[model samples]
Target: MVAGVLEVDPAEVTDESGPETIPTWTSLRHLQLVVTLEEVYGLSFAFEEIRDVRSVGALRDVLRAKGTVPA
Candidate 1:
């Protein structure tokens, strides 16, 4: 799902699932990403939440904390 948001091949996602190597995650992509994530997870993130999310793992953590992601 993160790969889809980044517009990259899912295979390129790392085993550790970090965001540092996600080339599409520049500042310009942030808003689009947040919107996409909101749709995917069915939850709206506050501006501060979006500001604090820096990585795919972090985003997943946020969704998990919100109980939005299906286990």
Candidate 2:
């Protein structure tokens, strides 16, 4: 999903991948990713949670906290 939003190869994305590491991860793309995740996971994120997610690992952690993904 991150790769799809950023238009990058899935293999190019890692736990540490973020706007700083991915040239295509513009602010707009980040918003799109958030929307996509919400739609796909059927869960909403708090403003602080959304703001705190800076990387794939962080996003995964949020999902884990929400019980949306396996730990």
Candidate 3:
């Protein structure tokens, strides 16, 4: 899902994947990713929480905290 939003192959994404590491992860793409994640996980992210998510691992942590993903 993160790779899809970044318009990259899933094989290219990892727990460290993020805008800082992915050139294609522009601001627009970031928003798209946020929206996609929210919809898929059925959870909304607060602005501060979104800002805190810096990588796939961080995103998973947030989802886990929300009970959207099992720990």
Candidate 4:
């Protein structure tokens, strides 16, 4: 999913993957990504939660903490 959003190889997307780690992960893409995740997971992210997501692992953590992603 991260690879699809970033337009990168799926192998390149891991827990460590993020904007800084992936060159294709532009700000615009990040916005689109957030929207996509929200829609796909049927959840909304708070501003601070979004800001706190620095990696795929972080995103999962945030979503899980918010009860968006299942445990």
Candidate 5:
């Protein structure tokens, strides 16, 4: 899911298990990821909220807050 959102290889996300922890995840990738996540989850995020997401886990938390992902 993270790889799809970032338009990167899925293997790139294999080792990622925390918030904003993926080393390859950059600011630009973050934007792309937020957009992709919104589309996939059918939810939107405020700029601040998006900026605040620092890891995959954090992203999951955000989605959970928006009722996009099951907790």
Candidate 6:
């Protein structure tokens, strides 16, 4: 999903992948990713969570905390 939003190959998306590593992960794409995750998971994120996610690992942590993804 991250790769799709970033318009990158899936293999390029590592846990550390984010704006720093993936040039396509612009602010607009970040919002798109947040909305997509909310819709797909049937859950919403806090403003802080949305603002704090800077990496794939961080996003995964948020999802796991919300019980949307396995720990």
The number of the candidate with the highest TM-score is 6
Encode model 5's per-residue lDDT on 1-71: one tens digit a residue. Answer: 68765656766554344334565677887888889889878889998998777777778888888977533
Q: What does candidate 6's lDDT look like per residue over 4-62, in tens digits?
A: 88899999999999899999999999999999989998889999999989999999999
lDDT (10s digit) by residue, model 1, range 1-71: 66776788888866345456776777767778788878877889998988888877677788888987633
> Residue 31 of model 5: what lDDT?
85
Total backbone collisions for each predicted model = 0, 0, 0, 0, 5, 0
Model 5 segments more than 4 A misplaced = 7-21
Over 2-71, each residue of candidate 2 has an lDDT whose tens digit, in order, gives 8989999999999999989999988889889988999989999999887878998999988888889823
Worst 10 contiguous positions by lDDT, candidate 1? 14-23
Stretches of candidate 6 exceeding 4 Å from the true structure: none
Write candidate 4's Cα lDDT for 1-71 as tens digits: 77788899998988888888899988788878888889888889898877767788888887787687633
lDDT score, candidate 6, position 12: 97
Model 1 TM-score?
A: 0.76
Model 6's C-alpha root-mean-square deviation from the true structure amounts to: 1.4
The TM-score values for the models, in the order shown, are 0.76, 0.92, 0.89, 0.87, 0.72, 0.94
Report the candidate with higher lDDT, 1 versus 2.
2
Clashing pairs in 2: none
lDDT for 20 in candidate 5 is 47
- Top candidate on lDDT is 6
lDDT of 1: 0.75
TM-score of model number 2: 0.92
Reference-based lDDT, each prediction = 0.75, 0.89, 0.84, 0.82, 0.73, 0.91
lDDT (10s digit) by residue, model 3, range 22-46:
8998878888888898998788999
Candidate 1: where are CA atoms >4 Å away?
15-19
Candidate 4 to native Cα RMSD, angstroms: 1.8
